[model samples]
Target: METNHINQSPIDLESLISGLKTEDARNLKLMLNIQSMMWGIAAVYVFISALKFIMTTSWYDKLGGFLTLVAFVAFALLFRSYYKEYKTIDYGIPTIEMLKKAAIRYELFQWRGLYVLAPLLLEGIGLNLMMFDDFTNLEPLNRILFFQISYFFVMVIAFLVGYIIWKKRQKPLRDYALALLKEFQS
Candidate 1:
């Protein structure tokens, strides 16, 4: 075959990208869908719990419940947006564009992660408010210590679980997308 040095043929990107839209893609879509559903369920649960708290006469309880309700609802919306992003992925689009979207969407950490962090901070504040009236028998210092210790442990456990999930699931998919993007770009 003569090398057409002057009129080189364009790269056949379709064949190269065809493999990417298969198993991992399906799994990622499924994962996002499940995550969205779980968040929706969590939002509902929090909403119900908030309603219970709101029914009480205590102002602290009502405020705490409101914050918690807002946090969980935000979480549900955030995850839903993630699922919506997945839905927007068009395989028919250019491979590079598709990969770029996948890479950004699958990244465990990004500017958009602030959306997750904000709700978490709100939840923490709400929990503290809700629990402040509890364990009143303990000394003030002891109560503070108890709340801090328990909250720290719970947050640590939650962070570890989230990190594990990202590492096990999203990281690999993001890495794969980045690899393909890099390969094609170079």
Candidate 2:
């Protein structure tokens, strides 16, 4: 059985801030690591796509190769931005103004990161379409409809996954920011 300790003293703001800051620092480190892994994953994906394009004679294949590179680079830049923002967040002791700034930037990061995922998903779909010759047989109207439906579906899925990831990182950072802000205000 789990024993619960009941009546306790008031919340210790200093201790709470310290604990939140510690968690934020840990989560920030994990985000940096995730960013590094993404770079490798993007590199490998681009390399494989390049090889596939080189082996194919179709003009569509060449276009797919170019799209792959563009897509990876774009997402990589977004991940890099997240890394840079976290690196500069001043996770150490901060003044009230600093916490305010960090809070705004963290919120901005969450929104921008979410938007980036949809485009990345779209680019992947575009490249896949180029590689598949089945689409060539479809009429222009049908092709457009097919792409529209697929893009919308893929983007919705990507946004949901991206939002979860952003929240995982954002929550800890936001908590730390709020704790600091509250302490400063008090």
Candidate 3:
């Protein structure tokens, strides 16, 4: 009878305290860790390529490579900060505090995103400058259609992928955190 009464209770204490036990939170941590490692590897590769470009005889290559390095370094640092934020999640913290952290962490767009635009613009400009020599021999129209149009398509694809990831993964985790917070408050 006691067991049956307990089962009929309105709230389950176990469910409330299991912060990281939720599937969404666990998945979020795993995804962040994996992405952080992958971005670190990509940063290293870009560093090597940038060095090669800077070592070339072409003046354009040198300038473009320097710009690209600056932009990519910013991206790498941003990704590292995200990784560090997730790493700081401590189970021992108060549940409300932990949930608040998770909510902020999963936000799809934050002020930092605005700051990223400068680096993104720099990268685009740098890439175009780097390709100047290659595109020089092509007809002007062909160069625009081939290089510029293709770059636009690549950016679009990347944006769509990022949106999908946020919607499918990050948004749900955020929603979950909010829901848990609401439950706690009531």
Best by TM-score: 1
Per-residue lDDT over 18-44 for candidate 2, one digit per residue giving the tens place of the 0 to 100 score = 999999899888877887787778778
Please give the range of 10 consecutive residues that has the lowest summed lDDT in model 3: 13-22
For residues 63-161, write the lDDT of model 1, one tens digit per residue: 777787778778777877876776667889898998998898887678988878889878877777778789789886787678778888998998899
Q: What is the Cα-based TM-score of model 3?
A: 0.63
lDDT of 3 by residue, 129-157 (tens): 67878978898568646766777788889
Q: Assess each prediction's global lDDT (C-alpha) against the native.
A: 0.79, 0.72, 0.79
lDDT of 1 at 161: 100
**C-alpha lDDT (0 to 100) for residue 90 of candidate 2:** 68
**Cα lDDT for residue 80, candidate 2:** 75
List candidate 2 segments past 4 Å from native.
Answer: 1-47, 92-94, 108-125, 128-132, 161-186
Supply the TM-score for candidate 1. Answer: 0.65
lDDT against true structure, model 1: 0.79
